[model samples]
Target chain A: MTMRSVGDGKAEFYELLPGREHVTVIEPRANPFRLDLRELWNYRDLVLLLVRRDFVAQYKQTILGPAWHIIQPLLTTLMFTIVFGKIARLPTDGLPPFLFYMAGTVIWTYFANVFTATTGTFAHNAHIFGKVYFPRLVMPLATLVSRLIAFAIQFAVFLGILAYFAVTDAAVQPNLWVLLTPVLLMMMAAIGLGGGLIVAAFTTRYRDLVVLVSFGVQLLMFATPIIYPLSSLPARWQFWASLNPIAPVVEAFRYAYLGQGTLSVGMLLLSALVVVLILSAGVVLFNTAERTFVDTV
Target chain B: MPRPVIRIENLSKYYRLGAIGSHTLREDVNRWAARLRGRPDPMPRTGAAEPETREGGGIWALKNLDLEVGAGEILGIIGPNGAGKSTLLKVLSRITAPTEGRVTMRGRVGSLLEVGTGFHPELTGRENIYLNGAILGMKTREVDRKLEAIVAFAETSQVLDTPVKRYSSGMTLRLAFAVAAHLEPEILIFDEVLAVGDRAFQDKCLDKIQDLARSGRTVLFVTHNMGPALDLCSRGIVLAAGQCAYDGTMNDAVRHYQGCAVGGRRQTR
Candidate 1:
């Protein structure tokens, strides 16, 4: 905070007093991995406003408005139930097909919503990013929250279906692990955000990556145990499936809420490690990209 | 008489030519290697070399230039196209990082680089006011305090709830400017977008700038329009070829600017 004086006799010692003045230094290159949570906290109002804008603006002229959030996932669940359960004969591990698919749909839809929205961060918001300065992470983070709200709505609908199955069938088990729902949701967010951010960062320089993103995310969902339970996989292949971090999350979620999927603490820990790794890498890539993407983008 | 609010040292930014995807795999590896081994860049895009990883091929938006702005000074930056006028403002506001040098600024820096940035067409006038304010770094509490003033200044209180897409471009610009005007940062940076609205609104913007200076806040303004810029700025700096060409009183800088434009000589001091 050493400041240069104007060289007049009036220069005073109170110039650099704490809290009275704040200083910012912009350099050509910086440690791109530095995560400034304090600055993000200071701009929390902006995050809330951005989330509100995204949520409220999209439904402005629509007839059904927010109901679309629930409808889209419900229809997707119906499609999955028909195609995967009825046509493909995928096993649902004794739980009802509709309930099983809806369980996975609520969480995966949240993931896809956050992922696809943030994957265009640099391209879509280049104008705002070029003109003003805020922690660029705020854009994607706000998308996560807004989509989380949509997920909440969809989850409530899923619960209604769960309640139907819980009374009619004794197979649906509500276990103590259900209490870990918040933690599971957070893990999924990290995966979506991390994967999205990495793609977004690359898309700034090579926009072709944008084309690959949605396709890749679709492939990712199928690779997970969404359409088919992890138990359906053979012994050798189950270990391979464990490599996909989201597999354990979907399985754990099913085990907690529906009471019938295998989840070892070791498997969960491995997946958590993968999620953290992806998220950190994404943040680092984002830090570097945000600083100079305006120029290249 | 007061401490300088902004201090820039050897500030320079180099942009790659046809910059997208120009970093061939070999070039990237070379750059990464150079950075890791503490060696200079394998290729120098501009003739000037950087301390770390010099760029491969690009133009320097700003060069080895140093400047200082004292507290409460309305320093005008006047330059031609590609003369680093907007680049300077972008660097000052932290919109983009410099490639060679650094800038340190005291107190909050709010930029009106472009008004109506991040304005959702689907959002109403009132909603956009809050959204744009937050985008420009105003806290919700601050925007709340100034909501009435903003509505009055923009004169769109009647259609506050109507979506902005329905508003005329002029009305939209007014609302955006109104929100930007109330940012009240310790330091303000702006581009010449103030010429957007009618003459009356232009005068209001100028008056608001003057009021900001009178309130002891620093202002950094960039404009291609010399007449209005001369009227508003107390001091002026003319830039050419990414370097400062002249720094003096507003009137003198405009004169020197004309001379430099005609002769194209390096008369920096």
Candidate 2:
């Protein structure tokens, strides 16, 4: 029998060998803790392609197309201004109600989008996951990046509003803390992604969590001060309210954009600590779930 | 001696029967209590069983299977439905985990467990090409390099930009197969999806698979059809009741499967 070598450095032969053993043994990993960074790095192009697929496929047949991205937030802000500002006569901390609610709506919208998309990672992509093998983390990670792209488009609308208010009226002022805008956005994303991954992990077997997610997010909005200012909370409840991870992010965003709301370095640091804890826990749970979610999902 | 590119040693996958959340918390607590006392499981009948016969509470999709695929070999895997064929492919592709045992694979694996796995009907044929290619682990540059050949092979260049939902099912299958075959990973797995296409396309796929094996790529093919198994593979394995019943030359394995199908004694090699 003649022996030939393959490109992967293994030898091939015409005759079957009786005693040869397999070089790679695949067993259930005792601990699915090791993240395959190299494999993920190799599949980075796929992540980019998936992001493009999501962004493009979302607006493919719609008449409004990408306009819906702007329209959704614009309409929501208008609704909030009428209900919370005009009807309820809520305080906007000396900032115009439209811009305040707009700022809060834009940031909250981004977090909500990322949370829902990432949380549905396994359920939505089960078909793809069942067929192929790549870094499973790519899907959730791609959702984060693509939603960030969507947020960028919406952020452009916010910038247009900011510029309009800056030149025409003195009601809204851009402070130096505007430099912290990117940091605040990153924290929102981390918290949403971290929370979404935990939920996605649980949803494989207990599908009740899937139904609870949308309902829970709506309830969470009431808890976060999106329609109202954090300063309006009674003095006793202020400390406990800041404990909500999203509370500090919305507060910081409003403070940066309008120079009106509270922006404390201490609270921001505390929010960052909460994000780190949730994100690490999310990563661990998500990694373990990805290995076997295909079967259960 | 040449080393085996794929090795499966005593691999097994156990699955719970029926719905995933069928048990109540009370039943779970009782089961745990029974186990704590070093006694037999309270509901042994509902416990895990081998996937082939489905006798117990749960089923073992695969049970203590030992297999090895040599480098550049085309190994045909054949069995009846629920014979652990799909389960084995899922385990090999790492889509699911094995409950017991281990499998080691030396190179990158490309699996076509189902055709058009990530294809979105709303996307155009051209766009689905890129998306599906990426899902199959091809980089943008790689897909770009193979774009012309893939489009040409599928014969869908005229309607390339049209949404795939408008295309006939055959067109979709052709495009999916063309992309999958052209990616050229080190190991390729196909799971009975070839039957979707016409006879001519099926023959074309078989020809491509033969060409792939000839070009020094390992292939694990699961199929009910024996013609391709005998024609393309040098070796084959027949799985029955979640275990390998026969493993030898392609012709012998096919004969063994035929015998079993006709209620004859299962001949082992």
TM-score of each: 0.91, 0.90
Error of 2 at A96 (Å): 0.7
**Which lDDT value does model 1 have at B243?**
97
Q: What DockQ class does candidate 2 belong to? A: acceptable
Q: Give each model's whole-structure lDDT.
A: 0.85, 0.84
Name model 1 segments beyond 4 Å from true: A1-14, A17-19, B21-56, B264-269
Residue-pair clashes per candidate: 0, 10
- Stretch of 10 with least lDDT, candidate 1 chain B: B44-53
Q: Where in model 2 is the C-alpha error above 4 Å?
A: A1-25, B19-55, B264-269
lDDT of 1 by residue, A85-122 (tens): 99998999988999899999888888888889889989
